[model samples]
Target chain A: EAGVTQFPSHSVIEKGQTVTLRCDPISGHDNLYWYRRVMGKEIKFLLHFVKESKQDESGMPNNRFLAERTGGTYSTLKVQPAELEDSGVYFCASSPYRTGPTGETQYFGPGTRLLVL
Target chain B: AQTVTQSQPEMSVQEAETVTLSCTYDTSESDYYLFWYKQPPSRQMILVIRQEAYKQQNATENRFSVNFQKAAKSFSLKISDSQLGDAAMYFCAYRSASGGSEKLVFGKGTKLTVNP
Candidate 1:
């Protein structure tokens, strides 16, 4: 089976530009998550999508960041007026609802490297 | 709140030798899961091995295994007969086994180098 996939393996944009990162998860996966690692920082969770609903977004940093999963399919993360600090590796992961919530093994994608100048 | 820490930023192991990466986490939840993920040059996060908090026996996947200390909140990964392919960034992660909190908390990561 094909694993999770992401778009635009690398992105370069200005500090005030808008950028959108996309993630296509494995088929039949209900739980999708987004995480990012800023320069010199550990990878941190951003948000989670269970089907078409936002299960958890407490990790979202601010309103400038937005995430959406329509029709319970792929997901997208959009950063508006991106700042220099937004330059980092954004990783997307997905897992089935089986194995309970926390027990499920997450499969990650080849992260999208965003560079803001 | 849960936090994971990796004390060693870098480690090296000779081929056919063994290497251990240390990790510690702080969490109030008793039942949870600890995992070790390997990120190679491709930058894809790959699950290496996992240990359930309730399991007393360590979890092993071929040459990779984990030493999980529940009381001490320590989880270390041991790679035996290390190969060149084992040289990568190893990350320790924690996940609460509860119903609502399912996100993984990851450490700063440890870079492992294999010397031939």
Candidate 2:
């Protein structure tokens, strides 16, 4: 099975520009998540989606950031009027929806490196 | 809220030697999961090993193993016979086993270098 894949492995844009990152999860996986890692910092969770509905979005940093999963398949994270602090590596992960002693293991994609100048 | 910490910013080891990466986490939940992920330069992050809090026994995968101390709230990764390919940024992460929250909490990460 193919792993999670992301589009535009690297993006460079000016501050105040809008950028959209896309992620295609593994086939048949219902759980999708987005995380970001700033330079020299830990990876922080942004949001999660189960199918077409959002499961949790408390981690979202601000109103400028928005994420959507359409048709319960792929996800997109949009940063409008992106600021310099928004530059970082954005990672998307997915896992099968299963409940058991062994919790769901997330598979990550090659993160998209965004640089806002 | 739970937090994960990796004290070591960077570490080095000679090829064929063993190295351990330290991690400490703070969590009140009894049932949870811990993970170690390896991210090589310009590559996707991959899982190295994971340990369920309920399991006393540590988790091992080939040359990679974890020293999980539940009481001490510690989870460390030990790489035996370290290869040059093992050089990467190692991250320690924690996840709650609850039904609603499935997001992972990650540490700042430790960069490992294997000298040949």
Candidate 3:
């Protein structure tokens, strides 16, 4: 099976610019998640999507960041007027549905390295 | 809120030797999941191993294994017969067992260097 794939392995943009990162989860996976790690910090969760519905988005840093899953097959994260602190690596992961038995294991992608100058 | 902690910032172990990396977490939930991820220099996060909160047995995968302590809220990883390819940033993670919250909470990470 093909693992999760992310577009634009590396992105470099200046402050006040806009950039969108995309992620394609494994086929048939119902759970998709977004996470990122800033300099000197651990990887933090951003949001999660179950099928076409967003299950959780409490981890989003601010309103400037937006995420959408049009058809539930893939997802996009957009940042408007990006700030210098927005530079970091954004990761996308997905897992099969949990059936209340054993917890599911999430598969991660290579991640996109975003640098806002 | 659940939080994972990795006390070691970095560690080095000679090839063919065994090394243990420490991790601790704080959570009020009785059931959850713990994971160890290895991010190589290529920057890809790979799942090394995982342990369920209710499982009494430690998890093992090939040369990688975990020491899970429920009472202490501690989960550690041990690499046996370490290889040069094992050098990378190892992160400890936690996930809530209830609800649809599948997001993982990660620790600061420990950079493991394998010396040949």
Candidate 4:
């Protein structure tokens, strides 16, 4: 089966520009998660989507960051007026329903490297 | 709150040898999940292995295995017969199993270098 796929493997934008990162998860997967790692830091969770609903977004840093899962299919993370600290590798992952079998593993995508200048 | 730590920032091992990466976590929750992810030069976070908190026996996949201690909140990865392709950043992660959320809390990561 095809794993999670992300668009624009690399993105470069100015400090005040807007950038959107997209993630297409595996078919039939009900769980989608967003994560990112800044320089010399651990990978931090951003948010999670179960189907089309936002299950958990406590990890979201601020209002400038927004996440949407339209039609409960794919998800998007948009950063407005990006700051220099936003330059990092953003990773998207998905997994099958935990209630069902085989939800222990998460499939990750080729992260999108965002560079803010 | 949960936090994971990887004391060794970098580690090296000769090919065909064994290497262990240490990880410790602090969590009040009894039920949780632990994971080890490998990130190669391509910057892809690949799931190497995982362990359930309730499982007594360790989890193993091929040459990769985890020594998980729930009481101590410690989880370590052991790679046997290390290969050059195994060189990468290994991150230890923790997730609350009962929160109805699958959010993972990761460590600072340990960069493993395999010498041939």
In DockQ terms, which candidate is top?
1
Candidate 1 is scored at a TM of 0.98
CAPRI-style quality class for the chain A–B interface of candidate 1: medium
DockQ of predicted model 3: 0.71
For B7-110, candidate 1 gives per-residue lDDT tens digits of 99999999999999999999998899899999998769999999889999999999998889899999999999999999999989999888776788999999
Computed on C-alpha atoms, the DockQ of candidate 2 is 0.73
> Of models 1 and 4, which has the larger DockQ?
1
Lowest summed lDDT across 10 adjacent residues in model 2 chain A is found at: A96-105
lDDT (C-alpha) at residue B116 in model 4: 94
Tens digits of per-residue lDDT for model 3, A1-117: 899999989999999999999999999998899999998799999999988899899999999999999888999999998999999999999999766635688899999999999
Would you estimate the TM-scores of all the predictions? 0.98, 0.98, 0.97, 0.96
Report the number of clashing residue pairs per model: 0, 0, 0, 0
DockQ for the candidates, in order? 0.76, 0.73, 0.71, 0.63
How does the DockQ of candidate 1 come out? 0.76
When 1 and 4 are scored with lDDT, the better candidate is 1
Local distance difference test scores for all models:
0.93, 0.95, 0.93, 0.92
Where in model 1 is the C-alpha error above 4 Å?
A: none
What is candidate 3's TM-score for chain A? 0.96
Which residue window of length 10 is worst by lDDT in model 2 chain B? B94-103
- The local lDDT score (0 to 100) that residue B34 gets in candidate 3 is 95
lDDT of 4 by residue, B1-116 (tens): 88999999999999999999999999988778899999898867899998888889999999999988888889999999999999999999988877566788899999999999
TM-score of 2: 0.98
Distance from true location, Cα of B12 in model 3, Å: 0.4
